[model samples]
Target: MDATADASTRKPAAFIGRRLLSLLYDLLPVVALWFLAAVPFVLLDVAVSGDVRHNIGPFSLLQWLLWLACWIVTGLYATVSWRRGGQTLGMRPWRLRVVADDGGAPTHGALWRRYAVGMVSLLVAGVGFWWAWIDRERLTWHDRASGTRIVRMSKRN
Candidate 1:
Protein backbone atom coordinates (compact mmCIF):
# COMPACT_ATOMS: atom_id res chain seq x y z
CA MET A 1 0.00 0.00 0.00
CA ASP A 2 1.19 3.49 -0.76
CA ALA A 3 1.51 5.23 2.62
CA THR A 4 1.19 8.65 1.06
CA ALA A 5 -1.94 7.73 -0.80
CA ASP A 6 -3.54 6.31 2.34
CA ALA A 7 -2.57 9.37 4.31
CA SER A 8 -4.12 11.63 1.73
CA THR A 9 -7.46 9.82 2.01
CA ARG A 10 -7.59 9.53 5.77
CA LYS A 11 -9.90 11.75 7.79
CA PRO A 12 -8.45 14.86 9.33
CA ALA A 13 -6.94 14.64 12.81
CA ALA A 14 -9.50 15.45 15.50
CA PHE A 15 -8.98 18.73 17.26
CA ILE A 16 -8.74 19.12 21.05
CA GLY A 17 -12.23 20.54 21.31
CA ARG A 18 -13.78 17.55 19.58
CA ARG A 19 -11.66 15.20 21.63
CA LEU A 20 -12.89 16.82 24.85
CA LEU A 21 -16.49 16.48 23.75
CA SER A 22 -16.06 12.78 23.09
CA LEU A 23 -14.39 12.35 26.47
CA LEU A 24 -17.31 14.00 28.18
CA TYR A 25 -19.64 11.63 26.40
CA ASP A 26 -17.45 8.67 27.38
CA LEU A 27 -17.54 9.61 31.07
CA LEU A 28 -21.04 8.19 31.44
CA PRO A 29 -20.08 4.64 30.55
CA VAL A 30 -16.83 4.84 32.47
CA VAL A 31 -18.63 5.90 35.63
CA ALA A 32 -21.11 3.08 35.19
CA LEU A 33 -18.28 0.61 34.82
CA TRP A 34 -16.68 1.90 37.98
CA PHE A 35 -19.89 1.41 39.90
CA LEU A 36 -20.34 -2.10 38.53
CA ALA A 37 -16.78 -3.07 39.39
CA ALA A 38 -16.99 -1.61 42.88
CA VAL A 39 -20.07 -3.63 43.79
CA PRO A 40 -18.35 -7.03 43.85
CA PHE A 41 -15.41 -5.74 45.80
CA VAL A 42 -17.65 -4.11 48.36
CA LEU A 43 -19.79 -7.20 48.65
CA LEU A 44 -16.81 -9.42 49.24
CA ASP A 45 -15.58 -7.11 51.92
CA VAL A 46 -18.93 -7.26 53.69
CA ALA A 47 -19.00 -11.04 53.46
CA VAL A 48 -15.52 -11.40 54.90
CA SER A 49 -15.86 -8.82 57.64
CA GLY A 50 -19.55 -9.26 58.45
CA ASP A 51 -20.03 -5.51 58.39
CA VAL A 52 -21.96 -3.41 55.91
CA ARG A 53 -19.43 -0.69 55.32
CA HIS A 54 -20.75 2.02 53.12
CA ASN A 55 -17.34 3.11 51.88
CA ILE A 56 -13.79 1.87 51.86
CA GLY A 57 -11.41 3.57 54.23
CA PRO A 58 -9.15 6.14 52.66
CA PHE A 59 -5.54 5.04 51.92
CA SER A 60 -6.41 1.49 52.89
CA LEU A 61 -5.43 -1.54 50.83
CA LEU A 62 -9.03 -2.20 49.89
CA GLN A 63 -9.41 1.32 48.63
CA TRP A 64 -6.20 1.06 46.63
CA LEU A 65 -7.33 -2.23 45.15
CA LEU A 66 -10.68 -0.75 44.27
CA TRP A 67 -9.01 2.11 42.49
CA LEU A 68 -6.73 -0.25 40.58
CA ALA A 69 -9.66 -2.41 39.58
CA CYS A 70 -11.56 0.59 38.33
CA TRP A 71 -8.54 1.68 36.29
CA ILE A 72 -8.12 -1.74 34.68
CA VAL A 73 -11.81 -2.06 33.90
CA THR A 74 -11.83 1.33 32.29
CA GLY A 75 -8.75 0.45 30.26
CA LEU A 76 -10.40 -2.74 29.04
CA TYR A 77 -13.46 -0.83 27.96
CA ALA A 78 -11.44 1.74 26.04
CA THR A 79 -8.85 -0.53 24.42
CA VAL A 80 -11.37 -3.16 23.38
CA SER A 81 -13.66 -0.57 21.85
CA TRP A 82 -10.84 1.08 19.98
CA ARG A 83 -9.56 -2.31 18.78
CA ARG A 84 -12.94 -3.56 17.64
CA GLY A 85 -14.12 -0.50 15.75
CA GLY A 86 -11.82 2.45 16.42
CA GLN A 87 -14.71 4.15 18.20
CA THR A 88 -15.99 3.90 21.74
CA LEU A 89 -19.67 4.54 22.47
CA GLY A 90 -18.63 8.12 23.19
CA MET A 91 -16.65 8.61 20.01
CA ARG A 92 -19.50 7.36 17.86
CA PRO A 93 -21.67 10.32 18.68
CA TRP A 94 -18.85 12.69 17.78
CA ARG A 95 -17.67 10.80 14.69
CA LEU A 96 -14.24 10.46 16.19
CA ARG A 97 -12.11 7.37 15.56
CA VAL A 98 -8.74 6.42 16.87
CA VAL A 99 -6.27 5.27 14.22
CA ALA A 100 -2.61 4.58 13.85
CA ASP A 101 -0.54 7.56 12.90
CA ASP A 102 0.15 5.75 9.64
CA GLY A 103 -3.58 5.69 8.87
CA GLY A 104 -4.10 2.02 9.74
CA ALA A 105 -5.74 0.18 12.60
CA PRO A 106 -3.75 0.76 15.77
CA THR A 107 -2.01 -2.17 17.48
CA HIS A 108 -3.12 -3.51 20.87
CA GLY A 109 0.11 -2.31 22.44
CA ALA A 110 -0.30 1.10 20.92
CA LEU A 111 -3.86 1.30 22.17
CA TRP A 112 -2.78 0.39 25.70
CA ARG A 113 0.01 2.94 25.56
CA ARG A 114 -2.47 5.49 24.41
CA TYR A 115 -4.77 4.58 27.31
CA ALA A 116 -1.93 4.64 29.86
CA VAL A 117 -0.62 8.00 28.76
CA GLY A 118 -4.15 9.28 28.67
CA MET A 119 -4.51 8.26 32.33
CA VAL A 120 -1.36 10.16 33.16
CA SER A 121 -2.63 13.08 31.16
CA LEU A 122 -5.71 13.12 33.35
CA LEU A 123 -3.77 12.74 36.57
CA VAL A 124 -1.72 15.77 35.66
CA ALA A 125 -4.80 17.89 35.10
CA GLY A 126 -4.78 17.23 31.36
CA VAL A 127 -1.47 18.92 30.73
CA GLY A 128 -0.66 16.26 28.16
CA PHE A 129 -3.91 16.94 26.39
CA TRP A 130 -3.43 20.70 26.53
CA TRP A 131 -0.02 20.20 24.95
CA ALA A 132 -1.83 19.60 21.68
CA TRP A 133 -2.52 23.31 21.40
CA ILE A 134 1.19 23.99 21.19
CA ASP A 135 2.16 20.89 19.24
CA ARG A 136 2.97 21.55 15.61
CA GLU A 137 0.63 18.74 14.54
CA ARG A 138 -1.92 19.31 17.30
CA LEU A 139 -1.20 15.86 18.71
CA THR A 140 -1.46 14.96 22.37
CA TRP A 141 1.32 13.28 24.34
CA HIS A 142 -0.49 9.96 24.11
CA ASP A 143 -1.05 10.39 20.39
CA ARG A 144 2.61 11.04 19.72
CA ALA A 145 3.92 8.57 22.26
CA SER A 146 1.73 5.70 21.11
CA GLY A 147 2.00 6.35 17.38
CA THR A 148 -1.77 6.73 17.26
CA ARG A 149 -4.14 9.55 16.49
CA ILE A 150 -7.83 10.35 16.72
CA VAL A 151 -9.46 11.45 13.49
CA ARG A 152 -12.72 13.19 12.78
CA MET A 153 -14.70 11.25 10.23
CA SER A 154 -16.89 13.08 7.76
CA LYS A 155 -20.60 12.50 8.06
CA ARG A 156 -22.09 9.92 5.74
CA ASN A 157 -24.61 11.16 3.23
Candidate 2:
Protein backbone atom coordinates (compact mmCIF):
# COMPACT_ATOMS: atom_id res chain seq x y z
CA MET A 1 0.00 0.00 0.00
CA ASP A 2 1.13 3.51 -0.81
CA ALA A 3 2.06 5.38 2.37
CA THR A 4 0.65 8.68 1.12
CA ALA A 5 -2.69 7.31 -0.02
CA ASP A 6 -4.38 7.59 3.37
CA ALA A 7 -3.21 11.15 3.85
CA SER A 8 -4.42 12.14 0.43
CA THR A 9 -7.87 10.78 1.05
CA ARG A 10 -8.67 12.99 4.02
CA LYS A 11 -11.46 15.46 3.33
CA PRO A 12 -10.61 19.12 3.32
CA ALA A 13 -12.36 21.52 5.66
CA ALA A 14 -15.95 22.25 4.81
CA PHE A 15 -16.90 25.77 3.80
CA ILE A 16 -19.64 26.11 6.38
CA GLY A 17 -17.58 24.62 9.14
CA ARG A 18 -14.65 26.90 8.59
CA ARG A 19 -16.88 29.93 8.23
CA LEU A 20 -18.74 29.18 11.44
CA LEU A 21 -15.55 28.76 13.38
CA SER A 22 -14.11 31.95 11.95
CA LEU A 23 -17.22 33.86 12.95
CA LEU A 24 -16.98 32.55 16.47
CA TYR A 25 -13.39 33.68 16.76
CA ASP A 26 -14.05 37.11 15.24
CA LEU A 27 -17.31 37.95 16.95
CA LEU A 28 -15.98 38.92 20.35
CA PRO A 29 -13.22 41.24 19.23
CA VAL A 30 -15.30 42.88 16.53
CA VAL A 31 -18.18 43.46 18.90
CA ALA A 32 -15.83 44.83 21.52
CA LEU A 33 -14.41 47.37 19.11
CA TRP A 34 -17.86 48.46 18.09
CA PHE A 35 -18.91 48.83 21.69
CA LEU A 36 -15.85 50.88 22.51
CA ALA A 37 -16.55 53.24 19.63
CA ALA A 38 -20.18 53.64 20.66
CA VAL A 39 -19.48 54.15 24.34
CA PRO A 40 -18.20 57.71 24.07
CA PHE A 41 -21.43 58.89 22.59
CA VAL A 42 -23.40 57.12 25.22
CA LEU A 43 -21.29 58.63 27.96
CA LEU A 44 -21.46 62.14 26.51
CA ASP A 45 -25.19 61.98 26.35
CA VAL A 46 -25.46 60.94 29.94
CA ALA A 47 -22.73 63.15 31.37
CA VAL A 48 -23.43 66.58 29.84
CA SER A 49 -27.08 66.50 28.88
CA GLY A 50 -28.53 64.09 31.44
CA ASP A 51 -30.32 62.48 28.51
CA VAL A 52 -29.12 59.65 26.26
CA ARG A 53 -31.10 60.84 23.25
CA HIS A 54 -28.65 63.57 22.26
CA ASN A 55 -25.48 61.68 23.08
CA ILE A 56 -24.22 61.43 19.50
CA GLY A 57 -25.42 64.95 18.59
CA PRO A 58 -28.23 63.99 16.28
CA PHE A 59 -26.10 61.60 14.19
CA SER A 60 -24.29 64.31 12.31
CA LEU A 61 -21.51 63.99 9.74
CA LEU A 62 -18.93 63.32 12.42
CA GLN A 63 -20.97 60.39 13.60
CA TRP A 64 -20.97 58.95 10.11
CA LEU A 65 -17.24 59.47 9.90
CA LEU A 66 -16.71 57.55 13.10
CA TRP A 67 -18.84 54.69 11.83
CA LEU A 68 -16.87 54.60 8.59
CA ALA A 69 -13.62 54.59 10.46
CA CYS A 70 -14.64 51.61 12.49
CA TRP A 71 -15.64 49.67 9.41
CA ILE A 72 -12.45 50.60 7.61
CA VAL A 73 -10.32 49.41 10.49
CA THR A 74 -12.05 46.06 10.55
CA GLY A 75 -11.93 45.66 6.79
CA LEU A 76 -8.30 46.66 6.60
CA TYR A 77 -7.34 44.20 9.29
CA ALA A 78 -9.06 41.38 7.47
CA THR A 79 -7.74 42.28 4.03
CA VAL A 80 -4.14 43.00 4.98
CA SER A 81 -3.82 39.93 7.16
CA TRP A 82 -5.38 37.68 4.57
CA ARG A 83 -3.10 38.94 1.83
CA ARG A 84 0.08 38.95 3.85
CA GLY A 85 -0.34 35.79 5.87
CA GLY A 86 -3.09 33.91 4.01
CA GLN A 87 -5.11 33.72 7.20
CA THR A 88 -7.01 36.00 9.56
CA LEU A 89 -7.10 35.43 13.33
CA GLY A 90 -10.19 33.30 12.96
CA MET A 91 -8.99 31.36 9.95
CA ARG A 92 -5.71 30.59 11.64
CA PRO A 93 -7.53 28.96 14.51
CA TRP A 94 -9.33 26.65 12.10
CA ARG A 95 -6.28 25.91 9.92
CA LEU A 96 -8.01 27.42 6.92
CA ARG A 97 -6.21 29.84 4.66
CA VAL A 98 -6.92 31.98 1.66
CA VAL A 99 -4.89 31.96 -1.52
CA ALA A 100 -5.26 32.95 -5.09
CA ASP A 101 -7.13 30.43 -7.14
CA ASP A 102 -3.92 29.76 -8.99
CA GLY A 103 -2.27 28.76 -5.70
CA GLY A 104 -0.31 31.86 -4.75
CA ALA A 105 -0.49 34.58 -2.17
CA PRO A 106 -3.08 37.21 -3.10
CA THR A 107 -1.78 40.48 -4.45
CA HIS A 108 -2.70 43.77 -2.76
CA GLY A 109 -4.98 44.67 -5.64
CA ALA A 110 -6.78 41.39 -5.37
CA LEU A 111 -7.23 41.83 -1.63
CA TRP A 112 -8.75 45.29 -2.04
CA ARG A 113 -11.02 44.08 -4.78
CA ARG A 114 -12.11 41.17 -2.64
CA TYR A 115 -12.87 43.44 0.34
CA ALA A 116 -14.83 45.95 -1.73
CA VAL A 117 -16.81 43.31 -3.58
CA GLY A 118 -17.58 41.69 -0.25
CA MET A 119 -19.55 44.79 0.75
CA VAL A 120 -21.63 44.49 -2.37
CA SER A 121 -22.27 40.86 -1.57
CA LEU A 122 -23.54 41.77 1.88
CA LEU A 123 -25.76 44.50 0.53
CA VAL A 124 -27.36 41.93 -1.69
CA ALA A 125 -28.22 39.76 1.33
CA GLY A 126 -24.95 37.86 1.70
CA VAL A 127 -25.28 36.06 -1.58
CA GLY A 128 -21.51 36.00 -1.76
CA PHE A 129 -21.09 34.04 1.44
CA TRP A 130 -23.88 31.66 0.50
CA TRP A 131 -22.27 31.11 -2.85
CA ALA A 132 -19.74 28.79 -1.27
CA TRP A 133 -22.44 26.36 -0.20
CA ILE A 134 -23.86 25.98 -3.69
CA ASP A 135 -20.87 26.64 -5.88
CA ARG A 136 -19.69 23.61 -7.81
CA GLU A 137 -16.11 24.37 -6.87
CA ARG A 138 -17.05 25.74 -3.44
CA LEU A 139 -15.90 29.25 -4.18
CA THR A 140 -17.69 32.20 -2.67
CA TRP A 141 -18.75 35.12 -4.84
CA HIS A 142 -15.99 37.27 -3.37
CA ASP A 143 -13.56 34.42 -3.93
CA ARG A 144 -14.63 34.10 -7.55
CA ALA A 145 -14.53 37.84 -8.15
CA SER A 146 -11.11 38.13 -6.57
CA GLY A 147 -9.71 34.95 -8.09
CA THR A 148 -9.10 33.44 -4.67
CA ARG A 149 -9.84 30.27 -2.81
CA ILE A 150 -9.87 29.26 0.87
CA VAL A 151 -8.35 25.90 1.62
CA ARG A 152 -7.59 23.84 4.67
CA MET A 153 -3.93 23.32 5.50
CA SER A 154 -3.05 19.73 6.01
CA LYS A 155 -1.44 18.95 9.36
CA ARG A 156 1.70 17.61 7.80
CA ASN A 157 1.90 20.17 5.08
Candidate 3:
Protein backbone atom coordinates (compact mmCIF):
# COMPACT_ATOMS: atom_id res chain seq x y z
CA MET A 1 0.00 0.00 0.00
CA ASP A 2 1.16 3.53 -0.65
CA ALA A 3 1.95 5.00 2.77
CA THR A 4 1.13 8.58 1.78
CA ALA A 5 -2.16 7.51 0.28
CA ASP A 6 -3.00 5.45 3.36
CA ALA A 7 -2.07 8.29 5.68
CA SER A 8 -4.25 10.67 3.76
CA THR A 9 -7.18 8.30 4.21
CA ARG A 10 -6.66 7.86 7.90
CA LYS A 11 -9.25 9.57 10.05
CA PRO A 12 -8.10 12.93 11.28
CA ALA A 13 -7.29 13.27 15.01
CA ALA A 14 -9.11 16.42 16.07
CA PHE A 15 -12.48 14.73 16.28
CA ILE A 16 -13.16 13.34 19.75
CA GLY A 17 -12.96 16.45 21.90
CA ARG A 18 -14.47 18.68 19.27
CA ARG A 19 -17.44 16.37 18.91
CA LEU A 20 -18.36 16.96 22.53
CA LEU A 21 -17.72 20.66 22.32
CA SER A 22 -19.69 21.01 19.14
CA LEU A 23 -22.64 19.27 20.79
CA LEU A 24 -22.44 21.72 23.64
CA TYR A 25 -22.33 24.55 21.15
CA ASP A 26 -25.24 23.12 19.18
CA LEU A 27 -27.35 22.93 22.32
CA LEU A 28 -27.77 26.69 22.36
CA PRO A 29 -29.56 26.77 19.06
CA VAL A 30 -31.49 23.59 19.72
CA VAL A 31 -32.73 25.04 22.98
CA ALA A 32 -33.78 28.20 21.26
CA LEU A 33 -35.54 26.13 18.64
CA TRP A 34 -37.27 24.07 21.30
CA PHE A 35 -38.45 27.23 22.94
CA LEU A 36 -39.88 28.40 19.67
CA ALA A 37 -41.44 25.04 18.96
CA ALA A 38 -43.02 24.99 22.38
CA VAL A 39 -44.99 28.12 21.66
CA PRO A 40 -47.55 26.46 19.42
CA PHE A 41 -47.85 23.50 21.71
CA VAL A 42 -48.49 25.76 24.65
CA LEU A 43 -50.87 27.83 22.63
CA LEU A 44 -52.86 24.79 21.66
CA ASP A 45 -52.94 23.64 25.24
CA VAL A 46 -54.27 26.98 26.37
CA ALA A 47 -56.83 27.07 23.64
CA VAL A 48 -58.16 23.64 24.45
CA SER A 49 -57.45 23.01 28.11
CA GLY A 50 -57.00 26.52 29.48
CA ASP A 51 -53.58 25.62 30.87
CA VAL A 52 -50.14 26.18 29.40
CA ARG A 53 -48.85 22.79 30.47
CA HIS A 54 -50.53 19.47 31.01
CA ASN A 55 -51.54 18.46 34.52
CA ILE A 56 -50.76 14.81 34.01
CA GLY A 57 -47.67 13.44 35.69
CA PRO A 58 -44.96 14.13 33.12
CA PHE A 59 -45.90 11.36 30.64
CA SER A 60 -49.19 12.34 29.15
CA LEU A 61 -50.11 12.18 25.48
CA LEU A 62 -49.58 15.87 25.33
CA GLN A 63 -46.14 15.54 26.86
CA TRP A 64 -45.18 12.87 24.38
CA LEU A 65 -46.50 14.95 21.51
CA LEU A 66 -44.54 17.94 22.66
CA TRP A 67 -41.43 15.82 23.00
CA LEU A 68 -41.84 14.48 19.50
CA ALA A 69 -42.25 17.98 18.16
CA CYS A 70 -39.09 19.14 19.84
CA TRP A 71 -37.26 16.09 18.57
CA ILE A 72 -38.35 16.72 15.00
CA VAL A 73 -37.39 20.36 15.26
CA THR A 74 -33.97 19.41 16.51
CA GLY A 75 -33.59 16.86 13.75
CA LEU A 76 -34.61 19.41 11.17
CA TYR A 77 -31.96 21.80 12.43
CA ALA A 78 -29.21 19.21 12.12
CA THR A 79 -30.35 17.76 8.82
CA VAL A 80 -30.56 21.19 7.21
CA SER A 81 -27.14 22.21 8.43
CA TRP A 82 -25.49 18.98 7.37
CA ARG A 83 -27.22 19.01 4.03
CA ARG A 84 -26.49 22.62 3.20
CA GLY A 85 -22.98 23.10 4.56
CA GLY A 86 -21.88 20.07 6.53
CA GLN A 87 -21.57 22.38 9.49
CA THR A 88 -24.11 23.46 12.09
CA LEU A 89 -23.91 26.77 13.95
CA GLY A 90 -21.97 24.86 16.56
CA MET A 91 -19.72 23.11 14.05
CA ARG A 92 -18.65 26.44 12.53
CA PRO A 93 -16.78 27.85 15.49
CA TRP A 94 -15.10 24.52 16.18
CA ARG A 95 -13.87 24.28 12.60
CA LEU A 96 -15.45 20.88 12.14
CA ARG A 97 -17.37 19.50 9.20
CA VAL A 98 -19.56 16.44 9.02
CA VAL A 99 -18.97 14.57 5.80
CA ALA A 100 -19.96 11.25 4.34
CA ASP A 101 -17.73 8.35 5.19
CA ASP A 102 -16.35 8.67 1.68
CA GLY A 103 -15.37 12.28 2.42
CA GLY A 104 -18.03 13.83 0.22
CA ALA A 105 -20.74 16.22 1.33
CA PRO A 106 -23.46 14.22 3.08
CA THR A 107 -26.52 13.48 0.95
CA HIS A 108 -30.06 14.30 2.05
CA GLY A 109 -31.01 10.78 3.05
CA ALA A 110 -27.66 10.33 4.73
CA LEU A 111 -28.12 13.52 6.72
CA TRP A 112 -31.58 12.46 7.93
CA ARG A 113 -30.25 9.03 8.77
CA ARG A 114 -27.53 10.65 10.81
CA TYR A 115 -30.10 12.76 12.60
CA ALA A 116 -32.29 9.78 13.50
CA VAL A 117 -29.38 7.67 14.60
CA GLY A 118 -27.98 10.64 16.44
CA MET A 119 -31.24 10.88 18.38
CA VAL A 120 -30.82 7.26 19.36
CA SER A 121 -27.21 7.93 20.26
CA LEU A 122 -28.24 10.70 22.57
CA LEU A 123 -30.95 8.61 24.21
CA VAL A 124 -28.51 5.83 24.93
CA ALA A 125 -26.36 7.95 27.17
CA GLY A 126 -23.82 8.54 24.40
CA VAL A 127 -22.54 5.02 24.03
CA GLY A 128 -22.26 6.02 20.41
CA PHE A 129 -19.73 8.65 21.32
CA TRP A 130 -17.73 6.27 23.46
CA TRP A 131 -17.61 3.89 20.52
CA ALA A 132 -15.23 6.33 18.84
CA TRP A 133 -12.53 5.54 21.40
CA ILE A 134 -12.57 1.91 20.34
CA ASP A 135 -13.19 2.30 16.62
CA ARG A 136 -10.10 1.94 14.49
CA GLU A 137 -11.10 5.02 12.56
CA ARG A 138 -12.51 6.63 15.70
CA LEU A 139 -16.04 6.59 14.38
CA THR A 140 -18.99 6.92 16.73
CA TRP A 141 -21.99 4.60 16.40
CA HIS A 142 -23.98 7.23 14.54
CA ASP A 143 -20.90 7.94 12.47
CA ARG A 144 -20.66 4.29 11.53
CA ALA A 145 -24.37 3.75 11.06
CA SER A 146 -25.02 6.92 9.13
CA GLY A 147 -21.84 6.58 7.07
CA THR A 148 -20.86 10.01 8.29
CA ARG A 149 -17.93 11.39 10.23
CA ILE A 150 -16.74 14.66 11.62
CA VAL A 151 -13.53 16.02 10.15
CA ARG A 152 -11.20 18.74 11.29
CA MET A 153 -11.30 21.64 8.87
CA SER A 154 -8.20 23.43 7.67
CA LYS A 155 -7.83 27.17 7.47
CA ARG A 156 -7.86 28.86 4.09
CA ASN A 157 -4.77 30.66 2.90
TM-score to native of every candidate shown: 0.91, 0.74, 0.87
> lDDT, candidate 1, residue 32?
98
Q: How many clashing residue pairs appear in each of the predictions shown?
A: 0, 0, 0
Model 1: residues >4 Å from true position, as ranges? 1-11
Q: How much does candidate 3 score in TM-score?
A: 0.87
Quote model 2's TM-score: 0.74
Candidate 3 residue 76 Cα shift, in angstroms, is: 0.5
Tens-digit lDDT track of model 1 for 1-157: 8978876776667899989999999999999999999998899788878889556779789989999999999999999999999999999988999999878899999999999999999999999999999986789999998999998888991
Give the candidates in order of TM-score, highest first.
1, 3, 2
Candidate 2 lDDT tens digits, 23-121: 579767777777877776567557876875664654675578667867876777778789778887887778888787656788888887887887788
Write the number of the candidate with greater lDDT, choosing between 1 and 2. 1
What is the full ranking by lDDT, best candidate first? 1, 3, 2
Clash number for candidate 2: 0
lDDT of 3 by residue, 40-151 (tens): 8677777878765655337677778889999999999999988888889998888888888667888888888888887788889988888788887888877877878888
Q: How high is the CA lDDT of each candidate model?
A: 0.91, 0.74, 0.82
Top lDDT hit: 1
On TM-score, who's better, 2 or 3?
Answer: 3
